[model samples]
Target: MKFLKIGDRNLLYPIIQGGMGVGISLSSLAAHVAGNGGMGIISTAQIGFREDDFYKNPIVANLRAIKTELQKARDLAAKVFENSKLTAKFLDILKNYTPFIGFNIMVATNKYADYVIEAVKAGADIIISGAGLPIELPELVEKGMAVSGNEKRTCIAPIVSSRKSAKVILKMWDRKYKTTADAVVIEGPLAGGHLGFSYDELNELGADTMTSRNYKKDKYDAEIKEIIEEVRIYEEKFGKKIPVFVAGGIYTKEDIAHVMDLGADGVQMGTRFVTTYECDAPDDYKQTYIDAKEEDIVITKSPVGMPGRAIRNDFMDRLKSGPIPIRHCHNCLALSVCDRKTIPYCITDALCSAANSDESHALLFCGSNAYRADKLEHVEDIMLELTEDMN
Candidate 1:
């Protein structure tokens, strides 16, 4: 294994735990990953859903929880490395790294700028945004950094699907904002939750139209390779090394080695982490993945206006009748265009229910490889299996 360096921080392992939202990956899972030598990501998606006022004042609740979760992660990191001599060189470097904590803020969220600023102000080490093209991300992050007054600029990475999106974002950032991405995550269609590809593209690749299945990594590698090539162009232009990490369908040790050979600096696994003991989701939710059969995982058009992968269940079955009315708005997204008449269901409600383990009436989002998990395990054990030397 090698180091994945972003900004002033160098992760001991080239692994980034994918930020599963709706309270799935929070302080607990993030702290453990960072403590064990990888970048720990906290999903800022409805993070405050548990707060007393979350239903009434989601923005306030989310902002407050951001501070709490970040502090918790920092505290955990401090306790883990407190004068501990795991190794002479390792301990010395760990003292300086900022716990490798990051925040995943979706680009499509309502008050997107507010989320970015708040996360940065709360001392997030990295800010990753996806779900839509984050064209203004550079400017947003720059403003946040200025407000933060932190000497070191927080690292910013965008999740992109192809070389085209990467080129557009890097060019816009460099020419318009005089900034570039610190890194880029290439998330393929096989990823859990929401996907980045068009419905047509997914179908043409032999995946089911409504639920993506039978998707293969080899089909996406060429695209990833081209994206790496495009990223290198900006790397030379900005005179910085922008590491590329591939996400989706990454499950085994061989999977990690495959991406590394294809020029990825690391691999980010979401579904692989969902079954971990430290994952923030309820036990029943974890068991949902374990119990899923290959045929049960399907893709659906999410209320958020994107194609998402999830385990098929009764709640999803209800959608077949027609668009479900939105009873309450959790204010999950910043946009005001959403309407109950047109959308499928209340995304906030469904996700929150799933997070709270009410799976029968909730959307059970999963990666294409989710059904592969057959048992519960510790994050430590999972990480060990993925990184163990096959030689």
Candidate 2:
């Protein structure tokens, strides 16, 4: 595989471990992925759920956890290099290794700007934002860099689902901030958590059925191609290479090859990593994916005012009857998208429930191919499996 270039660094593998929230891809997973030469991202979505004051003062807890997690991920990644049995190629790469630990800060989060600044000050190598178009991401990132007193700017990327979104983000960043994305991630309809596409769009693209949406037949492939071409324009204008990575249903080596052949520079994978031993989610949460079948995965409306793909479970089934009563709001999401009184359920509560292993009443977000996970494996094994042929 070609190296994923970000600023001056070269990631040995053009693979990114897609960030999962509510305590799903944290220090352990992020560290291991970076340790293995890919960009490892920690999701900032309610990251402080484990902190004692999470429920009482979530904002402060989450801010604190951002620094804590970044430090922990860096330390763990260092330990991997010091202790783990690594391949000779990896060792060669390690000679000048600078482990990439990124933060996935959603634009829809309540303290979005604070999260970005805090992550930068805490020494995050990169910040990847989505959940909404990060219109002012360049401004926030610049502020963070200035506040951190670091000459080395933190790389920033925006996740987009279509060519239009890509154009909008790139054009706005260039016009407003005199900057463009360091990289871009194209998340397709089949991704997990809150998706960028609406339910109707997904159905129209034949993404609702597993049998109809194979990689060869995926309609989203055309969209991905369009996005790549759109990014190419900005790349030319900025006189820099803004690498584009594709996500959603990217599972095996073949899946990686398919996107790369479509002109993608790399791939972002979330579901495939969920079943890894290094993943931060509870074993029971991982088990849900292992035990899932194609039919068990369904699309549902999210409290964040978006459609999400998740495993159908008791929690999902209960939502069919009526909106679940909101006990309390954590103020995690933006007020514009989620109102406590009207939202169907507390997204933070449901996600935390899943994190704590209460899957029956939890929101278990997953990608389309989550059902294919038959067993838990190591991050090293999965990374090797995906990049073995590339080397």
Candidate 3:
């Protein structure tokens, strides 16, 4: 059964390569995913982190990264289009060349709020949002128009962690905007970076007890089933259905099948995708995950006021156990909703440092199975490896 029937497409392979930021999972990873019969997502984040001499404005150095990333995504499209050897002879050159290129943009970013709109304008097939509540996604996307209508002008999918969150989003979407989610991704606690669960929740679920298990268990947590039922309620209320995709800590082919069995239309994977050759992440970043051990995975709070998962590294140790007072929140202007007014260090600084390959202060986001990715390979072979387990 196909889980990816958002508007028009029913992707046979429910594999959605999770989007990584700052040139981690750029166009090459996504392009190869689409080429191999899966949905590939491009992260429209500090994407230009590796642009060749692409610094013009010193004041907006923050935005310079985004420009570079977008350009990289575009350049990636060109390369994939050329390498496919499929001439522009087809009438639907886009459909023939770019199989399902989606963009994942964080709503809490200091970058442009209408980043998804820009992606739509850039001919992106879909936009996956996370990091914070994407309350204004529909209006943001509505402001622009798509170049073609293979699907809606452009589709938006907000990642949710619980059924309550799903219901709240649908209600907000219905009452405030009357728009429908093209799709939804239910991200569990196993995801990297900003987590959907709180520290207490992570602890209560036994996630805290098993940090050294090499992987976390979302299998019996019922997040996917709960989200499916919640989305069904929205469908019943609004008389429309929204496809549901599940992600977070999913690693094996059986994991994909289990989610599909539980009623998900798609599944998103982040950590394993980092091992791919087409992934735009730096060599050090990829190797870091490969070198990690089960005990190295840790859950900590983000500057955004959310609990997140990452590999325990020197930077985290410095941030946690340092003698300095961790009471500076220079960039905390309600950018991301958190209980605290400020945090010791700016999350933006840490993440940006990681994106720039500053391993000393870098924050590496990974799925629960991040330590399990032991080798590096090309995107095609990686996809085939995970899918082969299903076959």
Q: Judging by TM-score against the true structure, name the best candidate.
A: 2
TM-score of every model versus the real structure: 0.94, 0.96, 0.82
Tens digits of lDDT, candidate 3, 212-309: 35333554357678879888877677676677777877887777787888888768988878887777777888899999988888886666667778
Over 4 Å off, model 3: 1-3, 9-12, 50-97, 146-152, 209-220, 236-241, 323-342, 389-391
lDDT against the true structure, each candidate: 0.82, 0.87, 0.69
- Stretches off by above 4 angstroms in model 2 are 83-87, 90-93, 209-218
Q: What lDDT tens digits, residue by residue, belong to model 1 across residues 1-391?
A: 2466787667777789899889999998898777766678999999999999998899999988988998998888666445323212466455565558889999888888898888888888898888888888877777887998877777899999988999888888889888889989999878889889878878766554433455555777888999999999988988888989999878888888999899998888888888988888899999999999888998888876778888999999989998777888777775653555577788988998899978777999998888889998977677667666621
The order by descending TM-score is 2, 1, 3
Model 3 whole-model lDDT (C-alpha atoms)? 0.69
lDDT of 3 at 57: 33
Candidate 2 is scored at a TM of 0.96
lDDT tens digits by residue: candidate 2, 1-391: 3566787667778899999998999999999998877889999999999999988999999999999999999999877655544445457656767778889999999989999999988988889999888998888878988998977788989999989999999999999889899999999877888888876777787775442243334578888999999999988998988889999888999989999999999999999999989999999999999999988888788987788888989998999899988877788988887877788888988999999988777999999899999999998889778877765
Query: Which of the two candidates, 1 or 3, achieves a greater TM-score against the reference?
Result: 1
What order do you get sorting by lDDT, best first? Answer: 2, 1, 3
